[model samples]
Target: MRNLLMKVSYDGTDYNGFQTQPGGHTIQDYLEEAIRRLSGEQLKITASGRTDAGVHARAQVFNFYTASPIPVERWCMALNTWLPEDIVVSDAMEVPMEFHSRHAAKRKTYRFTINANQYPDLFNRRYQIHHHGKLDIAAMRQGLSHLIGTHDFTTFASRKSTKPSHVRTIFDAWIEKDTSTCRPGTRDQGIIHTFISGNGFLQHMVRIIMGTLIEVGEGKRQPDDMKVILEAQNRAAAGPTAMGKGLMLWEVDYDIASQEKHND
Candidate 1:
Protein backbone atom coordinates (compact mmCIF):
# COMPACT_ATOMS: atom_id res chain seq x y z
CA MET A 1 0.00 0.00 0.00
CA ARG A 2 1.07 3.58 -0.68
CA ASN A 3 0.05 6.83 0.95
CA LEU A 4 -1.07 9.60 -1.39
CA LEU A 5 -1.69 13.18 -0.39
CA MET A 6 -4.07 15.41 -2.38
CA LYS A 7 -5.00 19.05 -2.16
CA VAL A 8 -8.67 19.74 -2.78
CA SER A 9 -10.69 22.91 -3.26
CA TYR A 10 -14.47 23.09 -3.23
CA ASP A 11 -17.44 25.44 -3.13
CA GLY A 12 -19.52 24.19 -0.22
CA THR A 13 -22.74 26.03 -1.03
CA ASP A 14 -24.80 23.00 -2.00
CA TYR A 15 -23.44 20.34 0.31
CA ASN A 16 -24.40 19.52 3.87
CA GLY A 17 -20.76 19.69 4.98
CA PHE A 18 -17.35 18.14 4.32
CA GLN A 19 -18.06 15.01 6.32
CA THR A 20 -20.48 12.30 5.19
CA GLN A 21 -23.80 11.64 6.88
CA PRO A 22 -26.74 9.32 6.29
CA GLY A 23 -28.49 10.30 3.04
CA GLY A 24 -26.80 13.68 3.01
CA HIS A 25 -24.69 14.88 0.11
CA THR A 26 -21.22 15.90 1.25
CA ILE A 27 -17.74 16.61 -0.13
CA GLN A 28 -16.30 13.50 1.44
CA ASP A 29 -19.11 11.36 0.06
CA TYR A 30 -18.43 12.52 -3.48
CA LEU A 31 -14.67 12.20 -3.04
CA GLU A 32 -14.92 8.68 -1.68
CA GLU A 33 -17.30 7.65 -4.42
CA ALA A 34 -15.05 9.09 -7.09
CA ILE A 35 -12.11 7.20 -5.68
CA ARG A 36 -14.02 3.93 -5.53
CA ARG A 37 -15.06 4.36 -9.14
CA LEU A 38 -11.54 5.22 -10.27
CA SER A 39 -9.61 2.52 -8.42
CA GLY A 40 -12.27 -0.18 -7.88
CA GLU A 41 -11.54 -0.21 -4.17
CA GLN A 42 -13.17 1.33 -1.13
CA LEU A 43 -10.70 3.61 0.61
CA LYS A 44 -11.12 5.89 3.54
CA ILE A 45 -9.42 9.24 3.11
CA THR A 46 -8.19 11.40 6.01
CA ALA A 47 -8.66 15.14 5.68
CA SER A 48 -6.76 17.83 7.54
CA GLY A 49 -10.08 18.92 9.04
CA ARG A 50 -13.77 19.27 8.34
CA THR A 51 -15.54 22.44 7.27
CA ASP A 52 -19.14 23.09 8.28
CA ALA A 53 -21.98 23.37 5.81
CA GLY A 54 -21.64 26.32 3.42
CA VAL A 55 -17.97 26.71 4.28
CA HIS A 56 -15.68 26.70 1.26
CA ALA A 57 -12.04 25.66 1.02
CA ARG A 58 -9.09 26.78 -1.08
CA ALA A 59 -6.50 24.17 -0.20
CA GLN A 60 -7.78 21.35 2.00
CA VAL A 61 -5.32 18.50 2.29
CA PHE A 62 -6.25 14.85 2.55
CA ASN A 63 -4.32 11.58 2.55
CA PHE A 64 -5.34 8.05 1.75
CA TYR A 65 -3.66 4.64 1.58
CA THR A 66 -4.26 2.85 -1.70
CA ALA A 67 -2.92 -0.27 -3.37
CA SER A 68 -3.81 0.95 -6.87
CA PRO A 69 -0.96 1.46 -9.32
CA ILE A 70 -2.13 4.85 -10.57
CA PRO A 71 0.70 7.32 -11.05
CA VAL A 72 0.79 10.02 -8.38
CA GLU A 73 1.10 12.78 -10.96
CA ARG A 74 -2.07 11.67 -12.73
CA TRP A 75 -4.18 11.46 -9.60
CA CYS A 76 -5.46 14.98 -10.03
CA MET A 77 -6.56 14.49 -13.62
CA ALA A 78 -7.97 11.06 -12.89
CA LEU A 79 -9.98 12.26 -9.88
CA ASN A 80 -11.23 15.37 -11.60
CA THR A 81 -12.76 13.22 -14.29
CA TRP A 82 -15.04 11.60 -11.72
CA LEU A 83 -15.54 14.47 -9.26
CA PRO A 84 -17.98 17.32 -9.74
CA GLU A 85 -16.93 20.67 -11.14
CA ASP A 86 -17.23 22.48 -7.80
CA ILE A 87 -14.85 19.97 -6.26
CA VAL A 88 -11.37 19.63 -7.77
CA VAL A 89 -8.19 17.84 -6.83
CA SER A 90 -5.54 20.43 -7.57
CA ASP A 91 -2.47 18.30 -6.92
CA ALA A 92 -1.34 14.96 -5.59
CA MET A 93 1.85 13.45 -4.26
CA GLU A 94 3.03 10.13 -2.88
CA VAL A 95 4.09 10.46 0.76
CA PRO A 96 5.52 8.24 3.45
CA MET A 97 2.92 6.05 5.15
CA GLU A 98 3.59 7.80 8.43
CA PHE A 99 2.16 11.05 7.11
CA HIS A 100 -1.43 11.52 8.24
CA SER A 101 -3.28 14.60 7.10
CA ARG A 102 -5.14 15.59 10.30
CA HIS A 103 -2.53 14.71 12.90
CA ALA A 104 0.36 16.11 10.85
CA ALA A 105 -1.20 19.50 10.16
CA LYS A 106 0.79 22.27 11.86
CA ARG A 107 -1.41 25.28 11.29
CA LYS A 108 -4.69 26.21 9.67
CA THR A 109 -5.75 29.53 8.19
CA TYR A 110 -9.36 30.60 7.71
CA ARG A 111 -10.77 33.67 6.01
CA PHE A 112 -14.16 35.22 6.74
CA THR A 113 -15.47 37.66 4.14
CA ILE A 114 -18.07 40.32 4.83
CA ASN A 115 -19.46 42.45 2.02
CA ALA A 116 -19.98 45.82 3.67
CA ASN A 117 -22.34 46.91 0.92
CA GLN A 118 -25.83 48.31 1.13
CA TYR A 119 -26.74 46.06 -1.74
CA PRO A 120 -25.34 42.59 -2.11
CA ASP A 121 -23.08 41.69 -5.02
CA LEU A 122 -25.20 39.56 -7.32
CA PHE A 123 -22.44 37.30 -8.52
CA ASN A 124 -20.70 36.60 -5.20
CA ARG A 125 -23.66 36.53 -2.84
CA ARG A 126 -23.26 32.86 -2.11
CA TYR A 127 -19.67 33.23 -0.96
CA GLN A 128 -19.93 36.35 1.19
CA ILE A 129 -22.11 37.78 3.90
CA HIS A 130 -23.73 41.17 3.39
CA HIS A 131 -23.60 43.76 6.16
CA HIS A 132 -24.76 47.38 6.13
CA GLY A 133 -23.17 50.51 7.71
CA LYS A 134 -19.54 51.44 7.98
CA LEU A 135 -17.62 49.06 10.26
CA ASP A 136 -14.96 50.51 12.54
CA ILE A 137 -12.02 48.67 11.09
CA ALA A 138 -9.61 50.17 13.58
CA ALA A 139 -11.62 48.98 16.54
CA MET A 140 -12.03 45.55 14.99
CA ARG A 141 -8.27 45.32 14.56
CA GLN A 142 -7.69 46.18 18.18
CA GLY A 143 -10.18 43.54 19.31
CA LEU A 144 -8.61 40.98 16.97
CA SER A 145 -5.16 41.73 18.38
CA HIS A 146 -6.21 40.31 21.72
CA LEU A 147 -6.65 36.90 20.08
CA ILE A 148 -3.09 36.62 18.73
CA GLY A 149 -1.66 34.57 21.56
CA THR A 150 -2.39 31.32 23.36
CA HIS A 151 -5.58 31.36 25.41
CA ASP A 152 -8.51 29.30 26.50
CA PHE A 153 -10.95 29.94 23.68
CA THR A 154 -14.03 28.63 25.41
CA THR A 155 -15.78 31.91 24.77
CA PHE A 156 -15.46 31.48 21.01
CA ALA A 157 -16.32 27.83 20.55
CA SER A 158 -19.69 26.25 20.08
CA ARG A 159 -21.42 24.91 23.16
CA LYS A 160 -21.97 21.64 21.35
CA SER A 161 -18.26 21.02 20.96
CA THR A 162 -17.22 18.07 23.13
CA LYS A 163 -13.50 18.68 22.94
CA PRO A 164 -11.83 18.23 26.32
CA SER A 165 -9.60 21.25 25.93
CA HIS A 166 -10.52 24.68 24.55
CA VAL A 167 -6.98 26.01 24.70
CA ARG A 168 -5.50 26.96 21.31
CA THR A 169 -2.71 29.17 20.08
CA ILE A 170 -3.42 31.79 17.45
CA PHE A 171 -0.29 32.76 15.54
CA ASP A 172 -1.80 35.61 13.55
CA ALA A 173 -5.05 37.46 12.99
CA TRP A 174 -5.75 40.43 10.75
CA ILE A 175 -8.38 42.12 8.63
CA GLU A 176 -8.07 43.69 5.21
CA LYS A 177 -10.38 45.78 3.11
CA ASP A 178 -10.83 44.27 -0.34
CA THR A 179 -11.87 46.94 -2.78
CA SER A 180 -10.73 45.25 -5.95
CA THR A 181 -14.31 44.84 -7.15
CA CYS A 182 -15.54 48.14 -5.81
CA ARG A 183 -16.30 51.24 -7.83
CA PRO A 184 -16.07 54.71 -6.32
CA GLY A 185 -19.38 56.53 -5.63
CA THR A 186 -21.22 53.19 -5.78
CA ARG A 187 -23.36 51.79 -2.99
CA ASP A 188 -20.69 49.17 -2.42
CA GLN A 189 -17.63 50.29 -0.51
CA GLY A 190 -15.67 47.03 -0.19
CA ILE A 191 -15.48 43.67 1.45
CA ILE A 192 -13.92 43.09 4.84
CA HIS A 193 -11.60 40.08 4.86
CA THR A 194 -10.67 38.58 8.22
CA PHE A 195 -7.84 36.09 8.35
CA ILE A 196 -6.88 33.96 11.33
CA SER A 197 -4.21 31.31 11.57
CA GLY A 198 -3.96 28.94 14.49
CA ASN A 199 -2.60 25.61 15.64
CA GLY A 200 -6.16 24.21 15.82
CA PHE A 201 -9.71 25.49 16.07
CA LEU A 202 -12.77 24.41 17.96
CA GLN A 203 -16.23 24.03 16.44
CA HIS A 204 -17.49 27.40 15.18
CA MET A 205 -14.51 29.14 16.75
CA VAL A 206 -13.58 31.43 13.88
CA ARG A 207 -17.18 32.31 13.17
CA ILE A 208 -17.74 33.28 16.79
CA ILE A 209 -14.60 35.39 16.77
CA MET A 210 -15.72 37.16 13.60
CA GLY A 211 -19.11 37.89 15.11
CA THR A 212 -17.49 39.33 18.20
CA LEU A 213 -15.16 41.44 16.08
CA ILE A 214 -18.07 42.70 14.02
CA GLU A 215 -19.75 43.74 17.25
CA VAL A 216 -16.64 45.67 18.13
CA GLY A 217 -16.70 47.24 14.71
CA GLU A 218 -20.29 48.28 15.35
CA GLY A 219 -19.39 49.75 18.78
CA LYS A 220 -21.52 47.18 20.55
CA ARG A 221 -18.47 46.21 22.54
CA GLN A 222 -15.31 48.04 23.43
CA PRO A 223 -12.08 46.79 21.84
CA ASP A 224 -10.60 46.16 25.25
CA ASP A 225 -13.65 44.05 26.08
CA MET A 226 -12.11 41.28 24.02
CA LYS A 227 -9.61 40.75 26.80
CA VAL A 228 -12.40 40.57 29.35
CA ILE A 229 -14.30 38.08 27.20
CA LEU A 230 -11.24 35.93 26.75
CA GLU A 231 -10.60 35.89 30.45
CA ALA A 232 -14.22 34.96 31.13
CA GLN A 233 -13.74 31.48 29.60
CA ASN A 234 -17.51 31.34 29.12
CA ARG A 235 -19.33 30.81 25.84
CA ALA A 236 -21.95 33.42 26.73
CA ALA A 237 -19.28 36.11 26.75
CA ALA A 238 -18.85 35.92 22.95
CA GLY A 239 -21.10 37.22 20.24
CA PRO A 240 -23.23 35.21 17.90
CA THR A 241 -21.68 32.80 15.42
CA ALA A 242 -21.29 34.40 12.03
CA MET A 243 -22.81 32.74 9.01
CA GLY A 244 -20.80 29.79 7.74
CA LYS A 245 -20.96 30.84 4.08
CA GLY A 246 -18.65 33.77 4.68
CA LEU A 247 -15.95 31.55 6.11
CA MET A 248 -13.50 29.51 4.04
CA LEU A 249 -10.74 27.14 4.90
CA TRP A 250 -7.97 29.19 3.34
CA GLU A 251 -5.00 26.87 3.87
CA VAL A 252 -3.48 24.04 5.89
CA ASP A 253 0.21 23.94 6.67
CA TYR A 254 2.51 21.00 7.31
CA ASP A 255 6.25 21.02 7.85
CA ILE A 256 7.76 20.50 4.40
CA ALA A 257 11.20 19.42 5.61
CA SER A 258 9.73 16.53 7.56
CA GLN A 259 7.91 15.07 4.57
CA GLU A 260 9.33 11.97 2.89
CA LYS A 261 8.22 11.17 -0.63
CA HIS A 262 7.52 7.65 -1.82
CA ASN A 263 9.78 6.22 -4.54
CA ASP A 264 8.04 6.17 -7.90
Candidate 2:
Protein backbone atom coordinates (compact mmCIF):
# COMPACT_ATOMS: atom_id res chain seq x y z
CA MET A 1 0.00 0.00 0.00
CA ARG A 2 1.08 3.58 -0.71
CA ASN A 3 0.24 6.63 1.38
CA LEU A 4 -1.26 9.58 -0.40
CA LEU A 5 -1.72 13.13 0.87
CA MET A 6 -4.47 15.34 -0.44
CA LYS A 7 -4.82 19.09 -0.22
CA VAL A 8 -8.54 19.83 -0.15
CA SER A 9 -10.59 23.02 -0.22
CA TYR A 10 -14.25 23.07 0.67
CA ASP A 11 -17.09 25.51 1.26
CA GLY A 12 -18.63 24.14 4.44
CA THR A 13 -22.00 25.89 4.08
CA ASP A 14 -24.23 22.83 3.56
CA TYR A 15 -22.38 19.95 5.19
CA ASN A 16 -22.27 18.87 8.83
CA GLY A 17 -18.51 19.55 9.02
CA PHE A 18 -15.42 17.73 7.86
CA GLN A 19 -15.83 14.48 9.77
CA THR A 20 -18.03 11.68 8.54
CA GLN A 21 -21.41 11.31 10.26
CA PRO A 22 -23.63 8.26 10.08
CA GLY A 23 -26.76 10.01 8.80
CA GLY A 24 -25.44 13.34 7.61
CA HIS A 25 -23.52 14.46 4.54
CA THR A 26 -19.97 15.63 5.19
CA ILE A 27 -16.85 16.58 3.29
CA GLN A 28 -15.22 13.35 4.44
CA ASP A 29 -18.07 11.09 3.39
CA TYR A 30 -18.06 12.38 -0.16
CA LEU A 31 -14.29 12.33 -0.29
CA GLU A 32 -14.00 8.73 0.86
CA GLU A 33 -16.77 7.65 -1.49
CA ALA A 34 -14.99 9.27 -4.41
CA ILE A 35 -11.75 7.55 -3.46
CA ARG A 36 -13.47 4.20 -3.23
CA ARG A 37 -15.02 4.60 -6.65
CA LEU A 38 -11.85 5.81 -8.28
CA SER A 39 -9.34 3.47 -6.72
CA GLY A 40 -11.60 0.43 -6.29
CA GLU A 41 -10.20 0.12 -2.80
CA GLN A 42 -11.68 0.84 0.57
CA LEU A 43 -9.57 3.36 2.44
CA LYS A 44 -9.77 5.21 5.71
CA ILE A 45 -8.69 8.83 5.46
CA THR A 46 -7.58 11.10 8.30
CA ALA A 47 -7.64 14.89 8.29
CA SER A 48 -5.50 17.40 10.13
CA GLY A 49 -8.54 18.40 12.16
CA ARG A 50 -12.31 18.68 12.12
CA THR A 51 -14.05 21.87 11.07
CA ASP A 52 -17.57 22.59 12.26
CA ALA A 53 -20.57 23.09 9.99
CA GLY A 54 -20.57 26.31 7.94
CA VAL A 55 -16.83 26.70 8.41
CA HIS A 56 -14.81 26.66 5.22
CA ALA A 57 -11.27 25.45 4.48
CA ARG A 58 -8.82 26.82 1.94
CA ALA A 59 -6.21 24.08 2.27
CA GLN A 60 -7.18 21.27 4.61
CA VAL A 61 -4.92 18.23 4.48
CA PHE A 62 -5.80 14.56 4.65
CA ASN A 63 -4.05 11.26 4.00
CA PHE A 64 -4.99 7.70 3.11
CA TYR A 65 -3.28 4.49 2.06
CA THR A 66 -4.26 2.92 -1.22
CA ALA A 67 -3.13 -0.01 -3.34
CA SER A 68 -4.34 1.50 -6.59
CA PRO A 69 -1.88 2.52 -9.32
CA ILE A 70 -3.73 5.66 -10.33
CA PRO A 71 -1.52 8.62 -11.12
CA VAL A 72 -1.50 11.50 -8.66
CA GLU A 73 -3.10 13.90 -11.12
CA ARG A 74 -5.74 11.33 -11.96
CA TRP A 75 -6.61 11.08 -8.29
CA CYS A 76 -7.43 14.78 -8.25
CA MET A 77 -9.46 14.59 -11.43
CA ALA A 78 -11.30 11.42 -10.53
CA LEU A 79 -12.19 12.68 -7.10
CA ASN A 80 -13.43 16.00 -8.44
CA THR A 81 -15.61 14.11 -10.91
CA TRP A 82 -17.51 12.54 -8.02
CA LEU A 83 -17.25 15.24 -5.37
CA PRO A 84 -19.59 18.20 -5.09
CA GLU A 85 -18.79 21.61 -6.51
CA ASP A 86 -18.21 23.08 -3.06
CA ILE A 87 -15.37 20.62 -2.33
CA VAL A 88 -12.36 20.35 -4.63
CA VAL A 89 -9.07 18.49 -4.51
CA SER A 90 -6.38 21.02 -5.25
CA ASP A 91 -3.48 18.55 -5.08
CA ALA A 92 -2.71 14.90 -4.35
CA MET A 93 0.48 12.89 -4.23
CA GLU A 94 2.07 9.85 -2.70
CA VAL A 95 3.83 10.27 0.61
CA PRO A 96 6.16 8.29 2.85
CA MET A 97 4.47 5.43 4.62
CA GLU A 98 5.22 6.97 8.01
CA PHE A 99 3.75 10.37 7.15
CA HIS A 100 0.43 11.12 8.80
CA SER A 101 -1.42 14.28 7.85
CA ARG A 102 -2.54 15.21 11.35
CA HIS A 103 0.62 14.19 13.17
CA ALA A 104 2.93 15.77 10.62
CA ALA A 105 1.27 19.15 10.58
CA LYS A 106 3.43 21.86 12.17
CA ARG A 107 0.99 24.71 12.35
CA LYS A 108 -2.44 25.90 11.26
CA THR A 109 -3.77 29.36 10.49
CA TYR A 110 -7.39 30.41 10.75
CA ARG A 111 -9.15 33.58 9.62
CA PHE A 112 -12.40 34.92 11.04
CA THR A 113 -14.05 37.65 8.99
CA ILE A 114 -16.42 40.22 10.43
CA ASN A 115 -18.49 42.63 8.38
CA ALA A 116 -18.19 45.70 10.56
CA ASN A 117 -20.68 47.84 8.80
CA GLN A 118 -24.26 49.09 8.87
CA TYR A 119 -25.27 46.91 5.92
CA PRO A 120 -24.05 43.56 4.68
CA ASP A 121 -23.08 42.76 1.15
CA LEU A 122 -25.27 40.05 -0.36
CA PHE A 123 -22.45 38.46 -2.29
CA ASN A 124 -20.14 37.97 0.68
CA ARG A 125 -22.76 37.42 3.37
CA ARG A 126 -22.31 33.67 3.45
CA TYR A 127 -18.62 33.91 4.35
CA GLN A 128 -18.61 36.70 6.97
CA ILE A 129 -20.30 37.55 10.22
CA HIS A 130 -22.25 40.80 9.91
CA HIS A 131 -22.46 43.19 12.84
CA HIS A 132 -23.78 46.73 12.78
CA GLY A 133 -22.68 48.04 16.14
CA LYS A 134 -19.72 50.39 16.36
CA LEU A 135 -16.67 48.38 17.43
CA ASP A 136 -13.67 49.69 19.36
CA ILE A 137 -10.77 48.37 17.31
CA ALA A 138 -8.22 49.30 19.94
CA ALA A 139 -9.97 47.28 22.62
CA MET A 140 -10.33 44.30 20.31
CA ARG A 141 -6.63 44.39 19.51
CA GLN A 142 -5.76 44.57 23.20
CA GLY A 143 -8.02 41.62 24.01
CA LEU A 144 -6.36 39.47 21.34
CA SER A 145 -2.90 40.29 22.56
CA HIS A 146 -3.60 38.39 25.75
CA LEU A 147 -4.29 35.24 23.76
CA ILE A 148 -0.82 35.03 22.27
CA GLY A 149 1.77 32.55 23.61
CA THR A 150 1.04 29.23 25.36
CA HIS A 151 -2.00 28.88 27.56
CA ASP A 152 -4.54 26.34 28.72
CA PHE A 153 -7.53 27.30 26.59
CA THR A 154 -10.20 25.27 28.33
CA THR A 155 -12.32 28.36 28.79
CA PHE A 156 -12.46 28.99 25.07
CA ALA A 157 -13.14 25.44 23.85
CA SER A 158 -16.45 23.65 23.48
CA ARG A 159 -17.71 21.23 26.12
CA LYS A 160 -17.93 18.49 23.50
CA SER A 161 -14.17 18.17 23.17
CA THR A 162 -12.44 15.04 24.51
CA LYS A 163 -8.86 16.15 24.08
CA PRO A 164 -6.61 15.30 27.02
CA SER A 165 -4.81 18.64 26.97
CA HIS A 166 -5.99 22.20 26.36
CA VAL A 167 -2.56 23.75 26.46
CA ARG A 168 -1.73 25.23 23.04
CA THR A 169 0.95 27.61 21.87
CA ILE A 170 -0.49 30.45 19.89
CA PHE A 171 2.42 31.66 17.80
CA ASP A 172 0.47 34.69 16.66
CA ALA A 173 -2.95 36.28 17.17
CA TRP A 174 -3.99 39.68 15.86
CA ILE A 175 -6.82 41.56 14.20
CA GLU A 176 -6.57 43.75 11.12
CA LYS A 177 -9.01 45.84 9.11
CA ASP A 178 -9.23 46.08 5.33
CA THR A 179 -9.78 49.75 4.53
CA SER A 180 -8.44 49.56 1.00
CA THR A 181 -11.60 50.67 -0.73
CA CYS A 182 -12.16 54.42 -0.54
CA ARG A 183 -15.46 53.83 -2.37
CA PRO A 184 -18.75 54.43 -0.56
CA GLY A 185 -20.56 51.25 -1.54
CA THR A 186 -21.81 48.57 0.82
CA ARG A 187 -19.25 46.16 -0.62
CA ASP A 188 -16.48 48.57 0.21
CA GLN A 189 -17.45 48.74 3.86
CA GLY A 190 -14.51 48.09 6.17
CA ILE A 191 -14.00 44.58 7.56
CA ILE A 192 -12.14 43.39 10.61
CA HIS A 193 -10.35 40.13 9.93
CA THR A 194 -8.92 38.19 12.83
CA PHE A 195 -5.96 35.97 12.05
CA ILE A 196 -4.90 33.25 14.48
CA SER A 197 -1.92 31.00 13.84
CA GLY A 198 -1.04 28.33 16.35
CA ASN A 199 0.59 24.99 16.86
CA GLY A 200 -2.89 23.55 17.35
CA PHE A 201 -6.41 24.51 18.38
CA LEU A 202 -9.10 22.94 20.49
CA GLN A 203 -12.67 22.58 19.31
CA HIS A 204 -14.54 25.90 19.12
CA MET A 205 -11.45 27.65 20.48
CA VAL A 206 -11.15 30.15 17.66
CA ARG A 207 -14.87 30.86 17.59
CA ILE A 208 -14.98 31.62 21.29
CA ILE A 209 -11.92 33.84 20.95
CA MET A 210 -13.66 35.75 18.19
CA GLY A 211 -16.83 36.06 20.29
CA THR A 212 -14.94 37.38 23.28
CA LEU A 213 -13.05 39.86 21.13
CA ILE A 214 -16.30 41.02 19.60
CA GLU A 215 -17.66 41.69 23.06
CA VAL A 216 -14.55 43.68 23.87
CA GLY A 217 -14.99 45.64 20.66
CA GLU A 218 -18.59 46.39 21.57
CA GLY A 219 -17.58 47.65 25.02
CA LYS A 220 -19.39 44.75 26.69
CA ARG A 221 -16.16 43.39 28.15
CA GLN A 222 -12.87 44.89 29.21
CA PRO A 223 -9.75 43.86 27.33
CA ASP A 224 -7.84 43.40 30.55
CA ASP A 225 -10.42 40.83 31.72
CA MET A 226 -9.18 38.30 29.20
CA LYS A 227 -6.34 37.31 31.50
CA VAL A 228 -8.83 36.58 34.25
CA ILE A 229 -11.01 34.52 31.93
CA LEU A 230 -8.01 32.54 30.76
CA GLU A 231 -7.01 31.84 34.32
CA ALA A 232 -10.54 30.82 35.32
CA GLN A 233 -10.39 27.68 33.12
CA ASN A 234 -14.17 27.60 32.86
CA ARG A 235 -16.18 27.79 29.68
CA ALA A 236 -18.89 29.97 31.22
CA ALA A 237 -16.37 32.72 31.90
CA ALA A 238 -15.76 33.11 28.17
CA GLY A 239 -18.00 34.96 25.76
CA PRO A 240 -20.52 33.25 23.51
CA THR A 241 -19.00 31.16 20.75
CA ALA A 242 -19.27 32.91 17.43
CA MET A 243 -21.05 31.33 14.49
CA GLY A 244 -19.04 28.85 12.46
CA LYS A 245 -19.79 30.45 9.09
CA GLY A 246 -17.21 33.16 9.43
CA LEU A 247 -14.29 30.88 10.31
CA MET A 248 -12.03 29.48 7.61
CA LEU A 249 -9.05 27.18 7.83
CA TRP A 250 -6.70 29.47 5.98
CA GLU A 251 -3.60 27.29 5.69
CA VAL A 252 -1.74 24.28 7.00
CA ASP A 253 2.05 24.39 7.21
CA TYR A 254 4.17 21.27 7.27
CA ASP A 255 7.80 20.23 7.16
CA ILE A 256 9.64 20.24 3.84
CA ALA A 257 10.30 16.50 4.07
CA SER A 258 6.59 15.86 4.32
CA GLN A 259 5.96 18.05 1.32
CA GLU A 260 8.61 16.23 -0.71
CA LYS A 261 7.26 12.86 0.35
CA HIS A 262 3.78 13.90 -0.74
CA ASN A 263 5.05 15.20 -4.05
CA ASP A 264 7.09 12.08 -4.70
Task: Specify the highest-lDDT model's number.
Answer: 1
RMSD per prediction, one decimal? 1.8, 2.4
Residue-wise lDDT of candidate 2 within 1-264, one digit each (tens)? Answer: 788899999999999999987867999998999988887877779999989999999999999988888887788988999999999999988778888888988999999999887777689888899988878989989989998999999999899989999999999988889876325755344788999999999999999999998999889999999888998999999999999999999999889575675767
Residue 130 displacement in candidate 2 (angstroms):
0.2
lDDT of 1 by residue, 1-264 (tens): 999999999999999989888867999999999999999989788999999999999999999999999989888999999999999999898788888899999999999999987778899988899988778889999999999999999999999999999999999999889787777787676899999999999999999999999999999999999999999999999999999999999999998555653322
The TM-scores, one per candidate, come to 0.96, 0.94
Per-candidate count of clashing residue pairs (backbone under 3 Å):
0, 0
- Candidate 2's C-alpha lDDT? 0.90
